[model samples]
Target: MSNSSIYTIQPIEFRLDLKDPFLFTAHHIDHFPAGNTQLGPTVPSTPEKPYQMYYGDVVPGFPEHPHTGFETITLVESGFVDHFDSLGNSGRYAQGDVQWLSTGNGVEHCEMFPLVHQDKENPFELFQIWFNSSPEEKKQDADYKMMWREQIPHVLQTDSNGHQADIRVVSGSFLNTDALSRPPHSWAAAKENRVNIYMIRLEPHAELTIPATTATSTRFAYFYNGPLLYIDGQEIPFKHLVELKPDTEIHLKNSDQVASIMWLEGEPIGAPVAMRGPFVLNSTEELNVAFARYRQTHFGPWPWPTPAPVFPREQERFASYQKGVDVEYPERM
Candidate 1:
């Protein structure tokens, strides 16, 4: 079937295996020089926060983990994720709730679900966005906020074929309305990297279209539930982001079933982005500071690292226990 995206890929004509294409699995620990970081007889405190996150081919459950520098945007499509951080805040958002966690300076938090309850016939799906907080906000008090399904404003977008689109702005916009913009900061008005996040629903064989965003932006498109035959002039490798030329309108379709796609675009913050294990920093010095703090149990909210879990200290003992799944050790001679 010929489908059209915002803009067509010109039918460049590439062979694709929409049913099951090859994918490179991701990592809980994204280290430099690629591959896993060296581990000691016992993992350092930072790595043992007692959490398990689902990576490609990994069992899903989380004792939990820590993060800093960026905001985590979570949108639930089916199941739910209960989050508890050092701030003593706990909430389980499911089926149509969105949660945003901004860990600016630093924070020790964990994300996990006690069980996966099935949704009326659909499964669970979500998009976790990591946005860089302005360098200053990073060190401020940690914050947790959840917008319920009803709280999310709904607007109908229609394509030429009576396909009605339902959209929710987790943060950013729909025309003149800024329903989910950030909580006010210089970055909000500075106008550097414009990051817009949206939750969209498409009907069977339906088409959702959008105007061209820009040339220098990066778009992370994922189909958490259902399948998408994203049409760019040509047929793209199905189920994968068919990168289009800049200023190209986007046309997407739900062919296999009622598909759902999360679209997030932003200007590259262009900061020194460095991450290792649980810390993300701009310099080796900052990384060292994070390491020492975990080693000394000194890092906490408001000064350098933001406080994430109010009860992290209680889990200190289990923090040393690691099931140690398939750690992708670096391939070296």
Candidate 2:
């Protein structure tokens, strides 16, 4: 019998992999000379800090930029990301937090990595995925949201041998757990789309089977860091990408080390794509129109104090919307 699941498998190469400033403290003179001040990529760790700056200059982030006709989902694995938008929304979110922005029609935004720690290094790691929007939704107003770490659902499971797995549901439903609410215009918010975004961590030697959901939806797993993972008797090394068929379950076996993987599944919009710089649209005409409009208006003018504006240094994790709605996340233990 032919199995109806598990399709193309590939490896993922990050467009930008950054590990901030490498340390050379007095305690470890052997690793660096007395006055070594150069900065570059460092060893990767679970709690990555002071991530090397992949791009940008003094501020170490993407300063004011324009985006239209698409949405960006930024998952913060470590460190903090400050967001400022033309709509006057601003916030600073850190570890385990997520920022979802809908740049419908047009908008200008900035993502700056602010080193909040004084006595220690400020490490940062994150994934920014862009999702295409439907043509109608692309004309809607922009939406800015912060998915606080505490609000996102974490699903945990253990086997008979005590091996465990934890799945962080960033979007879509996982087992009995539903992802925190998404913006209204998001394609992931529609039930028919079957979009699933999850961060899965498996303990060493653990085994977990992810049940199949929608048969026609697209699904892919990005194994960013791990020793080894076995699927269908195939050995998947670290930094590999595995694509699975949506009709059947996925059996995962972690080798000797902890595994960190990202799961992204969604139905293809199947529309013509015309993308240029920060905008994604249906056709060349639409793309040109988006550019002309932004040039004419500057996306309604950035009202924030700075291009890479951040909240007060003492402020907690919170989002201040343009319409006067403010939501704050309480301090976590």
Q: Estimate each model's TM-score.
A: 0.65, 0.85
User: In model 2, which runs have C-alpha deviations exceeding 4 angstroms?
Assistant: 1-5, 16-55, 323-325
Q: Write the per-residue lDDT of candidate 2 for residues 1-333, one digit (tens) a residue.
A: 133455655555554221111000001001111111212123332332223343435445677899998888888877667788888788888878989898998889898766555545555677787777888879999998888888899999997789999999999888989998889998878867877788999999888888787765777777776878887556778887776776778888888999988877777677777878788888999988888898899889888776655554466777778645765654653
TM-score of 2: 0.85
Question: What would the per-residue lDDT of candidate 1 be over residues 130-189, giving only the tens digit for each residue?
Answer: 555555665665566666676677667777777667777666565655555454432332
TM-score of structure candidate 1: 0.65
What lDDT does candidate 2 reach at residue 51?
Answer: 37
Question: How many residue pairs clash in each candidate at the backbone level?
Answer: 31, 9
